[model samples]
Target: MANDKTSMQLVANGILKENPIFRLALSMCPAVGISTTVMNGFMLGIAVLFVQVCSSVTISMVKNLIHPRIRIPTYTLTIATWVTVIDMVLAAYLPEAYAKMGIFVKLIVAFAIITMRLEMFACKEPVGASFWDGLGMGLGFMIGMMTIGLVRELLGSGAILGYDVLGFKPLLFFILPCAGFFVVGLMMAFFNYIEVFYKRKKGFTS
Candidate 1:
């Protein structure tokens, strides 16, 4: 039972405390570039989740065999291999979504968050722990992207998932690259505020 609790905490840490976008502020490039629409962000999130999990597991399994001197390149290659496979699969099977996502899917190979996990957590942790960490981080990234996308889509185009909600766009700037920074900054502030409030409440109760 204690083990189960620890595992759940590991997952929650990524989703809430160390969220890739809102908390750690990693991988801002994709977060800003592909978040113009809900679909775009969601699709990119799915791709990242798959690659992060696979790469983390693979790295953990082989950590013992890797030489310390060249591990970074090896990790990069492993991540790139997964990214390539995913990119090809998407292009072949889901051509429409792939077309929309384009190079962003391939770009996951270069994301700092995924590589950081490979070096910081997966390399040092047991396979099971690494898997949970990867799962948590991946889900966090997905949720963050989805939130940004949802907000941008709703306010910028007055739509959700491409369906018109308000009959007209209330803020055209929300869909632009410049507005991504503003939206992300606002969301980061919101999450930080919630975190502060939670900590204060916990402290008072204790």
Candidate 2:
């Protein structure tokens, strides 16, 4: 029972408290670069989810064998291996989405968010905890990217996932790189406000 509770907390922390893009401000590059549409964001998120979980589990299984001095390189190599596999599989099977995200899929190997988790949590924890941590973080990243993509796509193109909703673009800027910053910042603030409100309501001071 205690283990289950701990796992739930780890997952919740990744999704709500330590979100890679929104809360922790990690991996902002992909968050901004690929979030032009909901599908784009979601696809990248799926890749990250798989890579993160696989890398975490792999690292946990071999943490004891990895030398402390070379763990960073080991982690990078492990992550790269998974990223390459996913990239190839996507190219061979799902050519359409792969065409749109091939380059971005390769970039996940270097994402600070994934690396940081391996170094900070996965390597030091048991396999079960690390897996949950990765899952939570991956899910959080997906949610963050999807939210930004949905908002930007809807407002900038007047559509959601390429479906026209408003008949006209409301703000073309929302689709641009500059708008990515604005959307992320605003969403970050929105989540911060919610946290503050909840804390206050519960009589907690932070």
Candidate 3:
């Protein structure tokens, strides 16, 4: 049915076309805050992905139960529950990365991307479609964060995922907070450039 196709398209668009960080430009705080290394970025990505998917599902399921006047509080409760679980699980098994990520882990509860998707898309869609949308959006965020971490590690630290690519001194400044903004900006611009060229070659409008 056309409706099903539209749902699928919405899901796909969330993941690739309207990525929370790269495309929609949401949740850059966590993206840049926790991506100091590959492991850190990977953990942060997984945590955020989990939080986003779980919160969306929960909110979707309870969408009709909450009154419109208090929907925001209900959504916050749903998000908080999942984020707490993620935090506890990571702290128990992955203490090192947990320590490295620090307060950023706790901050996931307030990530506007997850909340936005839950309210705007998930609450209005079927469970399956909401799930896919969450998956796509989460993966998009993961990809963007990992890309930033990869660049920062390679350029600022001369490694990818902590493995030495070249025996050269790194630019320590790139590992700093300011460099996160700089690297993310350049990387986004690069992605845009590539997308533009691809669209031109295909003669398709994005």
Candidate 4:
């Protein structure tokens, strides 16, 4: 039977309790590297989502077939296959975004987020639960990346998703790689405080 709490719990964990980039800080490479523009960040998130969902499902479905000693290699192979497909699709259709994203698309193969979820959750859980967990985690990742990208785009380019929002002059430094970390950190702290405040309001102990 599917665990009713699994999906909800996964959502809460990924969005609030254990965000991949914000809280757990697992996939920093893509999160910090390709998030200068909102479009790039969003596309990166979708790619990671694809990799996560496909890999989790593949691993969960075959959990019992692979020997314990060789499970990691098997899982990596599965994830790599999906990543390659995504890379090719992006390169073919979204060449501009692909060029902007640079090697981060290829780095999806090494994003620790996919492997961590496979090892920590998918390998041990049923397919349904694993799928939900992957979905939730992927959404959280998207949120984290978008949050940083939004701030950076607003400040650095005076725009949002390439559309000009604020008329303020651009701050060149906000587009730098170092600024990605700062923006992400501030957003993480903001989410953390919101989580804490919500728990306190609900009379839940941390």
Among all candidates shown, the one with the greatest TM-score: 1
lDDT values, one for every candidate: 0.90, 0.91, 0.83, 0.86
The numbered model that scores best in lDDT is 2
Task: Summing lDDT over every window of 10 consecutive residues in candidate 3, give the lowest-scoring window.
Answer: 1-10
Which residue window of length 10 is worst by lDDT in model 4? 1-10
Tens digits of per-residue lDDT, candidate 3, 71-154, equal 888888888999899999999998988888999988988988988998888888777778878887887778878877888888
Q: Where in model 2 is the C-alpha error above 4 Å?
A: 1-5, 196-206
Clashes (backbone N, CA, C under 3 Å), per candidate, total 0, 0, 0, 0
Residues 1-87, candidate 4: write the lDDT tens digits: 355675788877877678888788898877777788888879999999889999999999999899999988898899889999999
| Candidate 3 TM-score, true structure as reference | 0.90
Q: Please report how far candidate 2 places residue 58 from its true position, in Å.
A: 0.3
Expressed as tens digits, the lDDT of each residue in 26-81 for candidate 1 is 99998888798888888888899999999999999999999999999999999999
Cα error, candidate 2, residue 182 (Å): 2.0
Instruction: Give the per-residue lDDT digits (tens) of candidate 2, residues 1-206.
Output: 12444889999999988888887899999887879999998989999999999999999999999999999999999999999998888788888988887588999998999999999988888899999999999999999999999999998999988889999999999998778888888887898899899999999999
Clashing pairs in 1: none
Candidate 2 TM-score over all chains jointly? 0.90
* Candidate 4 or 2, higher TM-score: 2
Which runs in model 4 stand beyond 4 Å of their true positions? 1-6, 192-206
Alpha-carbon RMSD of each model: 2.8, 2.4, 2.4, 2.4
